[model samples]
Target: MTNLLRSIRTLPLLAFLIAIPALAAPTIIELSSEASRPAINDLVRATVSAEATGTTLGELSKQVNSLIAEALKTAKAFPRVKTQSGNTSTYPIYSKGGKIESWRIRSELSLESGDTAALSELLGKLQSSLGVSNLVLQPSPETRKKAENEAMLDAIAAFKARAKVIADAFGKPYRIKQLSVNTSGNVVQPLFRATAKAMMADAAPMPMEAGESQISATVSGQIELE
Candidate 1:
């Protein structure tokens, strides 16, 4: 009975002994930091839309469709793309006594995975064929997440560098204790937008400038102080 008591007492001590090293280790303190880089290391993407407007919806649709087909045929360097077909409505040109006089119809073609340089050249030729509807630069969801993670790691690295500086200043060199991460993206619009023009016979060819675009990733990280 006495030995059983002793064993029970000793078992608790053993447990504590095993846990001592883990408890005694210096705890790392966490510090958070953020870093932003403008227009660096980017994944380039482009959004191009073709629009045609006419007195009648059917006419607009037919004209735009014809232009799009020609663009596909004349595409010398641009990637072969499949544009999503969309329809848009325009208010009456002149409403007389609440009666519809004329209506406009527009179709949009949004495509992905086209070569940059070739796309620009194609655009130069295309604006005349199909009037540019809209354009934007951004990363897809998957690419965005990837860049965000990369940005976070970069921020963490920056944080580590700052932490080292602090430690050196204090005459106490340190190590990374703990870390967390975050990231963000912005939709930046272009300064200039292309004008509207339909490919009419003998009209001037488009002067397209599908210039190189930029994709940015932001990384933020928190490191624990040791």
Candidate 2:
């Protein structure tokens, strides 16, 4: 009987132990760090487009193709320039009465170069047949990569410094629970735009300016205090 009574007493203790909840997780603080640097725009890009309209799709296609081919050949003569064909489309032109009057075909050629002088001269030459659709000045791939690497280093250092500051102020040691790094590339708009007729009228080389681009890097994560 005494043993049975002892067993009954132990049952309540086991129940109490099971009812207790697990320990709470430690607190975490998030920190964000960023770094940015200016990079010179070293690359120039120009887009030229050719369009033709005719009663027949075949004629329009032939004309547009010839123009693009000539442009491509001219671009190839300049060794420093890189050339590629862009978007091509064929659509029907409707008259005021809602009837199809002609077929319109359009093609684009893209040119990129680090040599501003050569590219500008080539653009001037092609203006007779092709119109400038868009122009942009930006950092080259190599330059952007270099800037991103430098920014990443700066961001990581900043993150570590901030974590140390927080830990010291709180009188505790910190460990990095998670970390992520991200990089951003800059976009630059063209400074000038010219029509085909205007470009053809002027025999002088096209003038251009390469501005500056900003590269940025960010580091964010949670730091656990111990």
Candidate 3:
């Protein structure tokens, strides 16, 4: 009976010993690092829209379809350009007394190309029947990917440099406990409203200036000191 009581008394001490590592304090430091580079915009994207209104939805739909079909035919003539049909929306127009006066239907065509000259020429042709709704110049996917890879390398280097500085300041050796890296990029958006309006009045080729895009990468995580 005395031995059984002694064993029961030692149970709480044994449990405390097993939990010692879990109770230990964590020593970690959080840090962030980033890198960025410039990439030239090599792709052009444009959105052309055709809108029509009629007394009946059927008439409006027919008109819009004809306009889109013509645009698609013209776009297909250029083998290097990429074209896709976009959104089609139809809505009722209300009169002064809230009565339905007409139905308006709008359809969009999206165009993309690395050859700016060809895209410009196509845009000029389509503008006769469609209005320029949106235009953007950006880096191509391949270019963006290359830039991101480069930036990632730079960011990782910067992160290690910073981590070393931190370890030196802390006067201890450290190990990476956790880490994460991210990439981002920016595209230059030039005003195109005036340009589009000017193109509508003239048949001359659209003037294009592809600016630069900024690609960036960031590294963030925690390090534990030993």
Among all candidates shown, the one with the greatest lDDT: 2
Q: What is the lDDT, from 0 to 100, of the residue 128 in candidate 2?
A: 80
Tens-digit lDDT track of model 3 for 65-183: 99899989988888889999899999899999999999888888899999988998998888777888788999999999999999999998998898899999989888899999999
- Give the candidate order by descending TM-score: 2, 3, 1
For model 1, the run of ten residues with the poorest summed lDDT: 37-46
Clashes of 1: 9
Best by TM-score: 2
Cα miss at 120, model 3 (Å)?
1.6
Q: Comparing candidate 1 with candidate 2, which one achieves the higher TM-score?
A: 2
Q: List the residue pairs that clash in candidate 2.
A: none
Candidate 2 residue 169 Cα shift, in angstroms, is 0.8
Model 2, position 9, has a per-residue lDDT of 95
Rank list by lDDT: 2, 3, 1
**CA shift at 33, candidate 2, in angstroms?**
0.6
Candidate 3 residue runs with Cα over 4 Å from true position: 1-26, 193-199
TM-score for model 1? 0.56
- TM-scores of the models, in the given order? 0.56, 0.83, 0.82
In model 2, state the lDDT of residue 198.
51
Model 1 ranges with Cα > 4 A deviation: 1-30, 36-56, 80-82, 86-91, 94-96, 137-150, 161-179, 186-188, 198-226
Q: Can you write out model 1's per-residue Cα lDDT over 50-167, one digit (the tens) per residue?
A: 5554466777667767755666666534555334545544545666587767665555555444344445455556666465555555555565566566666667677777887777
